[model samples]
Target: MQIAIRADSSKIIGTGHIMRCMTLAHALKNEGYFVTFYSRAHEGNLNNWLANQGMDVRIIPAGSNSIDQYSTAHGSWLGATQAEDIQATLNIINTVPDLWIVDHYGLDHVWHKAMATRSQVMVIDDLADRRYDACLLLDQNLGRKESDYAQLTNAKILAGVDYTLLRPEFIEQRQKASIRQGIKNIVISMGGVDLQNVSGIAFRTLLNSHLHELESITVVLGHANPHRADMQLLASQATHIQVEVVQGVSNMAEYFARADLCIGAAGATSWERCAVGLPTVLVQLAANQQIAAQQLTKVGAALSLDIGQLESHLEPVVKELANNSDKLMGMSRLAFSLIDAEGTTRVVKEIKSLFA
Candidate 1:
């Protein structure tokens, strides 16, 4: 079977879409299916990184035109009009794929319908604001309900965190994870591309805080992050705390397993932390992240904050959790209960069943 995945990553769109799509593609490939990625050459795109993972990648040349004004809320993220993207994608593939999986916020029903005529259409989405035309639709956010898409599409909906597309390593780490107690070690991951340098700000706040138990701090940065040098400079100045700046981490599961607390963005990484039962102070970096962050907080799975609250609330939240081991334990249990880390397996099974 041949599968074509349409997903993109750039400074504006972030890497969560492509990362989750890559997880699904890897699972499909393991089942003896040929998977190819169709991406655009956006500045800071992950086409090269996708190829480095041994997947067949076809890059559509970046267009010079501005995004259509009438496109979706994230239309500017596409770097081109929806019609142009549809044609460029059609011009690349030689044969129709058995399944065409799209995970982009910029493309909506128009693109989905255009692709559905040529292949079985599937969509990986979080926001339900737009319409879609697909055979299957997956939304892995905690608060998402099937009713949200009732007026939008007739596609079979796979909703909630149960269908979260996590990598295999997270499952392994979860099984081997130990009970987390007080916050001694911390990990800060503000997203793949921290355009606002939230990681550095969080690190600085921790340094000035009164957390005597903080032994070490691990800061994870993406390869596309332009603030890498600035982050490294901040880490170098940390005299008391043992700060380790790791770039482009492949072993995030291990880091989550070892850390007592995580200060990161409330994006897809929220699910990864939950997989390892790592308590976190989630900061909402984008508007789309608000729902997940608020839901996580309401469920006791995490403590939520906005970008503006990081300076004032971050340290106090971390200190309160560190001081109260019982609170930390409860959050870990709730976080672990939110996701089982078998999402990729279940999703892959569903996709294969489409052909069977």
Candidate 2:
């Protein structure tokens, strides 16, 4: 069996889609099926990173056609129109790759309908706004349901947190979930592309606060972050504290297990935190993230905030959570309860059954 994944990662377009798709792709690949990726060369796109995974990838040219009209809120990120994207994808796959798993906001039901003529379709989406012509639809967000996608396609829906697409590494490492008494050894990982440098803001707040109980702080940055130097400077200024700045991490599960408190963006990494039972101070980086962040917080799984509020209120919030060990434990329990860590296996079974 063969599958062709359509997803992109870059500075403007965060890596969440590609990362989750990679998780599913890796799992499917392990089952002896061939998988390939078709991505456009957007500025910070994960083309290179995908190549490093020893996977077959074909990059669409790094430019856009003249198409200003778009239907979805994030469609501008596509860099090309729906027709152009389909043409670009078809140009490479002269013989359709059995199944097309698309993870993009720009290409809606129109794009899916166009591609449906060639092969079966599965869409990975969290935004319940657009329409789709898919056979299977997966939305791993906390509050997602079949009704949310009622207006869209008549696809076989895989909804809610149980189907969260976590990588095998995260699943394996989550067996050693962290047990937290109080907030210590803080890990600040505000989105991979922290254009606002929210991690630096949190770092400074922690340094300035009276929270001396924190033994160490680990700040995670991605290759696309321009504020890497600023984070290093922040670490240097914290003479009384031990600080580690890790970039392009391959072992995220280990960090989550070791962390007592996590200040991370409300993206694909939310499930990773919950898998390791890490109580997080979630920041919504984009409009798409608000639902997951708020839903997680509503269920007592996490604490969500905006960048401005994160800077203004993070100190007090962290202090309160740190001093109250009971609250931390409760939150950790709720967070862990939100995910089973077997999402990869569940999703793979669903995919395989599609062919069977």
Candidate 3:
């Protein structure tokens, strides 16, 4: 089988779409299918990283008509229009792949219909906000239901956290994660592009604060982060806090495995944290993430805070979790129970079932 995925990542659009699609691409490739990506050459895009993974990444040059279909706020974030995009994509390909995976929000039924004549369509969505013409629709978010997408599309629906599409690393690392204890090691990950520099706010608040039980702190910044220098300087000042700013890390699951606690955006990585059973202080980087934070908090899997409230509430929240070891342990168990870390495998099985 041959799979071609159309997803974009940029400073404004963030990295969730391309990152999740990469999981499905990897799964298909591992199952002996040829998979390729068609990503826009947007600033802060991960086209290089996609290529580094040994996948053929066709870069679509971004221009005025470019777009990111999922984004209602920044509809033109893709740097091209829906018509321009599909035309550019078709121009570059030798032949259409067996399956066409559409993972963007900006393009909808109209866009999907245009591509329908080319190949079978599979949609990977989280918001369930728009209509799609799909052969398979997977929304792996917690609390999602077939009904949420019932009106939008009649595609075969795979909904909820049980089918969270995570990389194989997370599942393997979850098995090796240490038993829970007092929160000492803290990992701060603020999405792929922390354009607002929330990572700086988090670092200053924690390292310079009165909370002293923290043994070590690792802040993972994305390659797209414009403020890596700022993060590095803050880490240097926190000599007593055991802080380090890192980027381009391929082993995220390993970090989650060793860390006692995590402070991160409630994006796609939320599922990865849950898979690894890491207690989290979830921050809502975007409006879309609010529901994930809410659902995780509702189940005692994580503690949620809005970005506006982060500076004021982060210390108190971290301190409270630190003082209460049993609660942290319970949170770990709940996080672990939310998903079995077999999301990609399950998704792969279902994809194959379509052929069967």
Candidate 4:
């Protein structure tokens, strides 16, 4: 099968989209499928990384962002004009693909509709916020239900963390790390690129909380984070905290093994944390993450906190979890149940079955 993916990674959008698609691409490759990528050449684009992975990438010039108009219209932190997006996508679809996979929040039905006519389009979305013109839709967050995409036209829904197509490394390490109890070893990973420097905010918040004095507090920042310097200073001030500012951590299993708890954004890491049985405090960083964060919270696996409410609720949360050991363990077990490491294999089998 010839598969092409529409995903981009940059300072603005972060690297999660390309990273997750790479996982799926690798799985498909191993199963004898030819995979290609269509990415925008934005600042910090993942063309180099994708090339390193031995996949053919077609790069398009970065789309124009109407900053003032976007902010005024939607109060959006990340917004692109529909015309620019449509043109970019049209340029990509000019070369037909057998299966087109799109993973972008800025795109909606307009792009989907145009691409769907040319290929069997599959959408990778965590947010059911927009209508999609897709044949198959994948939302690999905990507690995602098919009903969430009821409004989508002609969509085959693959919902929940059960379908999370994680990289092989995560699956390999899942069984190696037994759950650690009575330890306050926590991991703080915002994302590959935190545009607003939310990690610094989360770090400062941790310093003020009583949990700062816990046994071990490890801060994991990606190389692209703009606030690494500020985080370094914050880590210096907090003596109890052990901050590790790493770029590309090949041994992510080690971090997951060490973390008793994780405070992370509700993106790809949500499923990774669930797979490794790391209890999490989910913070919604973008509009797309809001539903996934709440859904995970409702499933008893994660504690959801709106970015705005973190200041007021964080103190009580820290005190409660630090004091109550049993409750923390329960949440950890709940998370462990949500994802199996073999999710990639399951998704692949389902896709192949569609052809059969």
**Top candidate by lDDT:** 1
Q: In model 3, where do residues sit more than 4 Å from their true spots?
A: 66-74
lDDT ranking, high to low: 1, 2, 3, 4
lDDT of 3 by residue, 256-277 (tens): 8899999999999999998888
Which ranges of candidate 1 are over 4 A from the true structure? none
Per-residue alpha-carbon lDDT of model 2 for 32-64, expressed as tens digits? 988999999998878988899888899888657
Predicted structure 3: clash tally: 13
In angstroms, give how far residue 220 of model 1 lies from its true place: 0.5
Per-prediction TM-score: 0.98, 0.97, 0.96, 0.86
lDDT of 1 at 260: 93
Clashes of each: 0, 1, 13, 0
Q: What is the C-alpha RMSD of each candidate to the true structure, in Å?
A: 1.0, 1.3, 1.9, 3.4
Global lDDT scores for all candidate models: 0.90, 0.86, 0.85, 0.76
Ranking by TM-score: 1, 2, 3, 4
Output the better candidate (2/3) by TM-score.
2
Better of 2 and 4 by lDDT: 2
lDDT of 4 by residue, 1-356 (tens): 77888887778678888888988999999999888898878787779878977988988775555543423222131245655655675676545777888887766676778766767888898767777888788888766789989976568899877788888888777887665465467778888887877777766787777764476667787646777778777877876555565556766667876788777898788888888888888888876677778878888777977777777786677667777778878887887787778888988887786668
